[model samples]
Target chain A: MNILNGSAYPNNGVHLNKRHRKAKLFSMLCSLVTWLGVALLGVLLYQVSSDGFKWLDLQFLTSFPSRFPYKAGIKSALVGTLWLISMVAFIAIPIGVATALYLEELSGQGRMNRLIELNISNLAGVPSIVYGIIGLAVFVRGLALERSLVAGALTMSLLILPVIIIASREAIKSVPMSIRHAAFALGATRLQTARDHVLPASYSGILTGVILALSRAIGETAPLIMIGALTYVAFLPEGPMDSFTALPIQIYNWVSRPQQEFHQLAAGGIIVLLAVLLMMNTIAIVIRYKTERKYK
Target chain B: MTMGTFRLVKKDCINNRGTRWGESLIHCGLALCTLISIVTTFVIIAILAKESFGFFEEVSPVEFYFGTRWVPLLEPSSYGVLPLVWGTLSVTFGAALIAIPIGLASAIYLSEYASHRVRSIVKPLLELLAGIPTVVYGYFALTFITPLLKTVLPEIQVFNALSGAIVVGIMVLPMIATLSDNALRSVPDTLRQGAYALGATSYEVTTQVVVPAGLSGVMASFLLAISRAIGETMAVTLAVGATPNMSFTLLESIQTMTAYIVQISLGDTPAGGIAYQTLFAVAGFLFLITLLLNVLSQWFLNRYREVYD
Candidate 1:
């Protein structure tokens, strides 16, 4: 209609304005949507902090969970979480990093190798609960670990193994191929080349993945539950063979109780879990940012 | 060449050959690491098959597959799994409804609208949401979200599926946003430029060019998020009740398959009994559906994703 107009200038300003208005509206909506995540985080933190702050004293951190919420603490659960994370780190990192490096070598494009690749991807997508089932069957019952910390750690290791492997693979893949090729051109063995160049280049990346995996393992409860680590032990675990309850499991037990005070106690447990998670995430970000800046 | 140089070269050659044996041994060790994941898959399959097989022997396949009743623990127990599957799907569907649009919008906003500063700040914060444990979400759903929802709608039960759906939606939101952002960011800038040259608004360029270009990835993100929701255990178990009612109503409590597995696992059913075996059966079904959704997500990206140089 504007083009058909005979005047030098057409009168479609309203139409153009409407289009611009729509664009502006959409831009605002997108910005709002983008911040919804951050918003949710803020709200969640606010809610938990409000509910749990009264119970977040030093005594709460030192005492074992008791029948009374006022006396309850995260001592046993926190220790178990630390023990579990340490065990998982010991078990998952070396294996996850090795798998990533082996896959990156591109040694043989064999059918079996491809199958392993596919298997890892599928494992990453498998629900964490399924890993719990596997833990129940193989670790708890089949191996007769009797719901020990070893069984829980082994199961948690498997649960986060795929995440670590995938992240490490990505990190290794992002290491420019030219670095490896140049090392090979220098007549260095694959092992030597990886050790001297790729390993240094990818260590931070691997650290980030390992931290993420360990953090996931720390927060994990379902697989532990499936493994029947349900003992409400007022005492700390003495060994890997001892039964344990994790922070998340403790929180779950607390939340299930029909008392308002127990709910507050669960909130306190959440604050501790979130604190640990935040610390791990902060370390990951520091490693990532430091290395990223050094490279760039 | 001098004799000294000749001897040094010979020694180097010998050293290289000697270490080759050690290198191959290390290589085998690394290869073993890769094989562990494969072994894990097989063990999962074997366990599921063995336990579920026991369950199927006692309960007829027809009833287990088609029967509407799911009273695995009661007298005169029925074995139909349809309601549990429906409950799981209903929650997944509701979660998808909440997650997809907001996640896509976040993807678009970060990739197309937000400046670098905002993107960097918000992305990690979003990840923090995903990093928080599911049990925390459960606590929030029960204490915060349920009470909040009840204030608005009084008839909504304390253990309704809506609370579970809402929290699961929140739990998977970061994942969806992050995945879809990658997809949208991967769409070549040249397409956006061309759309701009054709006088398209920023919104138009995103919706028509960018989103359409990253269609499969966005769709795959949706699928993966849905898969995550189905496997969500703690939040649903705590927020959604363990009662396996056949009702699909949002106000009524519903038992999801994950919730059922948690129920039986938390119970005192003997390890070898039919009730105990039902956990594996439900888990096997849960695994199959989530696995299928995952594979479908992969297939969507691989088969339909638009490739740009």
Candidate 2:
């Protein structure tokens, strides 16, 4: 008021102050909403632990799922989740990294390159269930994979490939151009420059993306469900071709049942699922932070 | 020494040729790996198209698009997809209604008001929320949300759309918050400063200057969030139930396009059978809807992206 209208607006100052206070209150309300979100997460955790902690034991993790909730263990589902994640990482990482390298290093900002870039981003947003339908049609049926662990993994790999590729491309793009030039000055070819200079510099970032993608793959239920991951598996999958039930599917199955005990089991399964998810995410975030500091 | 040096030079030359050969081999392998992603898009489209063609041949387009009922398994199977589409619409609309305001409010707070220390603590928690599996959210919807709603609404069904929509809204909250935060943060500080110089309050500057500037990005985020809510399967499948009712009331149990796919796929529908083929047609519709939404969001993001020099 002093700067704009000098003493002329002095009488209006009270109104302006009132408006400012209202705005401040509104802003504070917004901040509270954000905290409300955090509080929701806390409540969810509290609920899960209260319902689930009693049943969460070594036997719960080791034994095969049983008809009785007390006897049921997540051994097969746990093992199946591990096997599925490994398979997804096996298929997604190298391909995602290579695609990132191709986009960041080899391709220019030509029309085709831009189209591919756009396609990758859009693919990232495609609903997980659509990927499930595709998996059902292609891998499970067309490829005759017979709803095996391999089929589930392939579907998940496809579902997460875009996330990994996008993250890797960002990592590769962040590597300084002078590093590649330094390698080239030593009589290195483009491939040699990328391999010796860029790839090493960006590998940590790439690893973070791969780990994050795998974390997501592990939590995914729809794509695996679409691929016909068995809802009830008494035995562990012997190989990639064998039928498997993952933790998420098991949780969903148990929740869908009418029994109160199964609901408790579902809560326990959520705890395990969330613990693994948070662990992987923490690892990814740590790697990302470390790499960021190193670069800085 | 000269004779030995000459031998070393000749050996180096041979090794260079071998390295070149190895490089080409590795290059081809990497390129093939990259090709898999491009091939995946085509394969999805082709498979959906082929099976969808079979479905359309059996069920007329008029009936498929305009028909109100969606009972594919029952006798005199009515393949009208309107019910499924409407189910999706109501669920998505409910989710958007829940997610957009809270998500945008939090985004504004994070971008404009949060201290750096508070931000670092909160951002990761949001990521953790995002990292939660949909299945777990499904379980929560069934076990927590539905029962909680029963206390408030007394006569709510066990598998109503309200709980499903609420959980789906929660699932999408992180996306909207993160994206809108990015959008708000990308607004130039100079604009806020200019407003402040004119004695505008922080709220005035944020809502008037920053939000308007970031409008397109925020709009894009809304579209992305809606698309996600629409495609969410397990939570809806579990909480919303598989009854394909065309009611607009959020309290009713409704089946979405995705829930239908899950319901059918969970059971053994034989290959080339009507039930199996019907899923592909639904998948094709879902694919088109999501692809269109994604492309539209991308377009908004690209076209109206505020570029600062």
Candidate 3:
């Protein structure tokens, strides 16, 4: 009986050891895969930075595009992207905030409210290319806007509207209910309480959401491409009605060309685009951090 | 004194009424905007339906569904959508295959094992991946990634689906990781504690318990990611050649449905022409697929939502 028990102890020890080894192996594999993704991202960033750094001067940024590769600049595309983002922010912020306030604060928990909420969530997931198609059929053809900056901006506004609404709703929801009740008890009306107390409290949060949404809109390429951002606009758009190119479209046009120089130009455009995106994202992060701290 | 008291009382009443009215007006205005957005959805559907119907009048629905060829620009101009659909599926499938493992693993590491400082740093870095524009991704796919692939695989085409799919997978990895992390985080800590008490390994608990419990949200993320892959335009358009051939090889060039729509849109496909109408028809199909996926995800989430007190 003693011999049998000792033999069983060794078997159990071996089994436990095997299990531990298996767990270690699994963890190591998971860590390796995660690291691989990070490595790939690093390689991509390195390639873009290295290939484009030579041409990323003030002259490359400010001058107008020329026929020759070396003389080409992204002046029009840069201005157009800025203009489009501004218009998108202008169009999206008010409506999105209003919708969020109504949904979160004013609207009763009813079927219609639920439907609206569901619709917005669903719309947020719809592939952006579908928006491009809608913009093509509705804005370009139906409204007769043609291939213009206004059309692109309008399309982008719609694309990012749901994002803004979702973010604003979260912001509005974060406001303590006790504050609303206190204002009401002090003979402050609903409108006054919401406007003065609630809106102020939520302003930073709402602004951060709006900025993030706008940043997303700025990076979008599908809808704008569908709306016909010109591939090679040599001059800046004179008006919203004028055809234009954004940075992404210009990068796409350059990359599609057969020449190595154009590829370098595409990389340069990417650096500029990344700078704008990073700046916008940083502002958003700062605002979000500040708002979170205020709430805390 | 009586007049002053009466005027003060009247002023207070008027102020209260005015505030109430203003609140009502704001609510009404917001409702009106929601109404407008809903109306816009309807309007888009109507336009797409009308145009697609016009397209169907010229071509049979059967041809659009299953016919093997897609020659919308040729003399015969067959409108078989199979090739385009096949191309779309191949690229999206390739992308999902690449994205799922990497994204899920990243989410697991971040949520289950990483320290607070590591998570704070890694999360934003992951998000930076999403912030990169699809066009830049397209550029990378076409210029950098393709050439790199060509070194090992000499048969790879200049504008192949593999490079586009890989870049798109990278672009979408953050989205998947973020959503999946949120899901995993939502799992009750008590459940994890129970697993630990049972002497299960951390990996075993994570894979068997936490991931399973969060499966619905994870599935929703995957569905959304697939929808994103399917609807991608510029990246695929720039990298995947405009050829609409139906093939499974990752090395061969392919054209997705969105790319085809973009190509025709770029050209002068006259309003009310078959080509123009075809864009709507294709879009209608795209719209239906994405809508179905979104609805299904919502349904799944609602059905399986974890109820915690």
- Candidate 1 lDDT over residue span B183-207, tens digit each: 9999999988887776667877888
Worst 10 residues of 3 chain B by lDDT: B1-10
Best of the two (2, 3) by lDDT: 2
Query: Candidate 3: misplaced stretches above 4 Å?
Result: A1-14, A293-296, B1-19
lDDT of 3 at B140: 83
lDDT of 2 by residue, B273-297 (tens): 9999988899889989999999999
What would the per-residue lDDT of candidate 3 be over residues B45-135, giving only the tens digit for each residue? 7877988989999999999988888899889888989889988898888889999998998888888877898788888888888778888
User: Arrange candidates by TM-score, highest first: which order?
Assistant: 2, 1, 3
Model 1 chain B, TM?
A: 0.92
| Model 1 regions more than 4 Å off | A1-14, A293-296, B1-19
Model 2 residue pairs with clashes: none
Candidate 2 deviant stretches above 4 angstroms? A1-14, A291-293, B1-19
Residue B165 C-alpha lDDT in model 1: 87
What DockQ values do the models have? 0.51, 0.48, 0.43
2 or 3: which has the higher DockQ? Answer: 2
> Can you tell me the DockQ of model 3?
0.43
Tens-digit lDDT string for candidate 1 (A85-197)? 88988999999988888777634555555666777888998999899989988898889998899999999999999999999988887888788989999998888887788
What's model 2's overall lDDT? 0.86
